[model samples]
Every structure is written in structure tokens, then in C-alpha cells.
Target: MFQSILSNLAIILLGHLLMSTLITYRERFSKHLLYIYTVVLFSTVSITMLYLPISFGDYRLDLSLIPLIFLALFRGWKITVPVLFIVSAWHFFMGSDETLSSIVFVLILPTIFTLLLYERKIPTNINLKILFIITACWIISDLPIILFIPNGMEIFKNTFLLRYISFLSVASIYCAFILIGYKNDRLKQRLEFLASHDPLTNLLNRNKFIEIVEVKMKESDTNHYIALLDIDHFKQLNDTHGHLTGDSVLKEISSIFNKYESDNLKVARYGGEEFIIYLKTVYDKQAVRTLEHIQNEIRTTPFHSNNGGSLHVTVSIGLAKFESGSRLYDVIHQADNHLYSAKNENRDQLVVSFD
Candidate 1:
């Protein structure tokens, strides 16, 4: 009998599409752009729903609560607060006699429900949990309308069941929409990370390292130093142990590099058993001390094989400070020369360029 909510139902569907698209594609958009987009998004949908409300036999109601609740649960306050504020201000300013009731039911009640549930542990699956809260919100908001307003019981009898069913479906569909979009975004981020990082050590891969180094070198006037380190007798150690053990040793060395890494320094896996470090330092001595510290840490740290066997390990380091007018490869070649010199003389030593 009450097919009048068709427009509101359609509005809810549009809201679903709008919100889902934003959630899925937000990584592509800048932070400020997305911020404006969300505020406009929720405010527009909410205000439109409120203006074109459904006729509940005699009372008028809008399906704005679902989006408000969704925003609260997922987007948190940054997006939710401004959207809530914009919608609330519009309703309070442009509304009629039932404006107070509209604020309470359409805006405040659902938001409070979401706030109480935020980050608190609940025992049920997400869909059911959301359903329960939606139902509670609907019931609470309708009761005052059902009791205080005229013919409240008669309106409840005529339209409550159908309206409830429609809105409950909208809330569940909105939940699914958000979940699928969120999963897609996360998967995209993971794939991007894997593409640019070495899975074994989770360090920057060779190509990514070169990309960053080129940019950093061109942009800054700071003194830059490069150090190339290679494991001493890595092949022999792998032959004595196993490939798994070799992998463990590599990861352990990566962890030590990570410990010393800072904003001024970057580290990457150049190739097998070889790591490159780049840093900005005012004094050549600082570069020497840093490389020496890394060299010492490697010597002292225990290396383990796959079968839990303890093994000895050491690295030879070649350090060179970048000259302003020269190319990146020139410095790398110089570092390589020093590295071979260290290996030829003795293993487990640090060699600095005379230049």
C-alpha cells in the first residue's frame, strides 16, 4: 500500500554507490581532495534524503541514519564529524515543526549508537552486529514518534513493518558495499608494496632504490655518501649450510641495517649477499663511523641456519663520499674498487676511498 518510499529507496541505492566508489578509489585521490569529497558526499546525500522524506502513513521519515552510522563505523571522526555537522546544520535551519524530532531521530540517535560501539569488541559477525544496532536505533527513534505524535500507533500498524524491512536491507547492503571496497583497496596497496620491495628481506629492490637515489641526489645539496657491503665467503657459507640458512643470514643483516636507518640514510639490497647504503652527512668521519658501526654490528651479531645451527658471518664494506660534479655510477665504481681492495687484503674489514 505504501510504495511512496520508492524515491527514498532509490536515494539509498545512490548513496551506496557514491560511498562505495569513494572508499575503493580513495588511494588514488589526494588526502585533501578526498576530505572535501567525503564531506560533500555525505552532506549532499543526507540533506537530499531529509528533504524528500517518505510518508509514514501520517508522519514523515527519511533514511538518513544508515549512512550516518556507516560513516561513523568506518570513516571515523575526520570524515564523520564534518558530514554530521553539515547535515545537522542544514536540517536545523531548513526544517519545519518536527525539526527537533528530525535532529534526534535522523541525526543524533544513530550517531550515538555508532559512537558507543566504536572500537568496542562485540561477539557476533559484522553484518549481524550492524543489523542489531540498526534495529535498535529504528525502534528507539520510532517509539517517541509512535507515542507522542498523533495517530502514532495507527501509523506504526500501517507502515512500520514494510519500512523497517526496506531500511534494514539498505543497511545490510551498505555494509557489504563498504566491506568489499575496503578489501579491494587493501589488496591494491599490498600488490604495490610487493612490486617495489624484495620479499626475502622486505628491503627496497634494486630498481626502486635507483629511482629514489636519482631523485634525492638531484634535489638536495647535502653531502651524500655511498657504502657497498658484501658478505665474506657467502658462497662457501651457503655450500656448508643450505639455501634456507643463507636466506636467514640475509634477513638478519637486513634487520641490523634497519636498526641504523634514519631519514638521512637509505638502505637497499643491490643483489645477492650485497647491500648498498646511502646517507647525507656533513663530515666524512661521520660516514666512516656509521659504516664502521654497521660493520662491527654484523661481526658481533649471531647468524642462524634454517635448522637452528649457529654460524659465523662477516662483511667487507667499501665507502665513498659523493663528489658534487660526478655521476652516481662513478661513486659506485669507486666504492667497488675499495670493496675489492678490502677483500684482496683480508676479509671482514672496512675500506675508505682516498679521494
Candidate 2:
């Protein structure tokens, strides 16, 4: 029994390490961690079958409850039911007699019921109701063995009691681990998002925009167009109102851009009141038309202030198509120059040039 336990523990550790590595490779940590735990639990069951003694008179403890709890915590009831069924099959195949097999099946039924009560969210507390139901199921699943044993009541009093305690201890530990992992995963995601996005407008920041633009430019055909847009008299707006009002206006304009922009158009908050849009197309006229439409939309929409007042804002845009032998920076500078010219000439117009 001691050797069997050690071997199972070793298997669990090895499986955990392997699955953790696989999880690290995934983009999302929450799903990865759940999958890792499931793999480890299944590996533990397989290892136990190899090393553990299963005889007619011997009462073998089932470790399948761990996976059910994990499934419930991570994937909810839908996954737990199927996992329970698999565990039951594994138990029957590992030399468990018909009586023990029936008992295992019976015990798994309550787990199904317990799982049904699980919401997709991990419970803040270990659910006492579910725990009690699980205990009851385990007892019921062992009923056949309990009934047919030579000293049936004595076997239930000693063996089943110990098994129940062990199961609960393991489950509690698993739940704690899962919760910690969940919190850590959420924190990491939040940090990553903040690093990539502007806090005020919730749009991609200049740094992230440069990274994306570089990649796109390297892979892009020569026909793409790059546009720079500047909010006309943005500093004046801040001077007239407060910085807070200016921020609100920026946010409002960002929302409009997000709503109207297509997947092929990459928009970013490129420092202060300046924004950049990269349109992946050969048609310079289409890109100019798109910017004109955005300018028109902004002009028509009245930005309401907290003081029950309203203001109209306009944007000056300059666009240039990508040249075959030119650098990305060169394209951006050309667009910025044109934007400066637009601001000097017509504050709310778009100027498009391929040359």
C-alpha cells in the first residue's frame, strides 16, 4: 500500500509538471491551468491502477473524486458528468469486482447531482452542500461492497470512514490551488492589457501601434495606405474647458473610430490628440473616403459635457499610399506633413496623395 501510494504520488507530480509546461505555451492561462489539473488527475488514476492491489476481499479506495471536483471548479457540471463516467469505467477495469463496480457507479451519481449545482464560476467557499452530497454518493457507491463483506458494518466503520476523510482533504487542497491560479491569471491579463492600451481612451497606445504597424508593413503589399489624423485645436479645447473635458472628448472620438473602423483598418491613439489609421488596401481613394466619412460622423455628432453644455469637434486628416522602396517611417512622416497642411488649409478635411 505504501509503495502504491508513493508511485501514484510520483505519477501525479510528473503529470502536473508536463501539463504545466503545456499550459505555459497557451495564450490564456485559465483554460490552460484547468486542462493541466485534469491531465494530472487522470494520470494519477492510471498510475494507481498499475501499482495498487485490487483483490476480492480488499477494499480499494477510488481517487476519481479529485478530477470530478476539479472539473466542477473549472468547467462546471457538463464536464464533471463525463469525467465521472470515465472514472467509473477505469475503476471497473482495474480488477474491482461487480459489487465494487456497482458501488462506484452508485457513488458517481451523487457527484453528478452535486456537479449540477455548480455554476461556471468557482465558488468563493467550499460548498458544504455539494460536499455532503459527494460523501453520500461515495457511501452509496460502496454499498454493494459494504453489504457483501464478511464483517460488513465493521468494514464500513473503518475503511469507508478513512476513505471519506482522505477524499475531502484532497478536494479542499485542489480547490484552494485552483482559486489561487485563477486570481493570478486574472492579474496577469489585466497587466498585459494595460501595457498595450491607453487608459483614457482604451485604444491601442503608440508603442503597441508601432509594433503592429512594423509587422503589418513587413508583410503588406505595396498598395496599402497610411493616414494620420489630428483633432483640430485640441489644446484650445483643453484651454477653453478643463483637461477633464478634453479627455472626455478624446474618449468619445475613440468610440466613434472603434464603431466605424473595419478589421483591415488598424487605429491607434498615437500620442496626445493625434491618432493614426492604417488601411490595408491599394485604393488611395477608398482610404480617403473612409477618413472623410469618419470626419463627417464626428462633425454631425455633438459632444455633450457634464455641465449640460455641448461642443462640436473636427479632425484634419492626411493620407499617403505605401511606396515600394520607402520606409514605414517615411510614409508616416509624409502623412503627418499632409495632416499639418490640412490643419493650415481646411481644419476638417482629408488630403490624400500617392506621391
- Each prediction's whole-model lDDT (CA): 0.80, 0.69
Best-performing candidate as measured by lDDT: 1
Question: In model 1, which range of ten residues has the least summed lDDT?
Answer: 115-124
- Model 1: per-residue lDDT, tens digit, 216-256? 78756578877889999999988989888999999999999
Cand. 2 TM to true fold: 0.75
Clashing pairs in 2: 103-141
Off by over 4 Å in 2: 1-14, 27-58, 76-161, 220-222, 260-263
Worst 10 residues of 2 by lDDT: 47-56
Give the CA lDDT, 0 to 100, for residue 247 in model 1. 94
Model 1 segments more than 4 A misplaced: 1-30, 119-125, 150-159
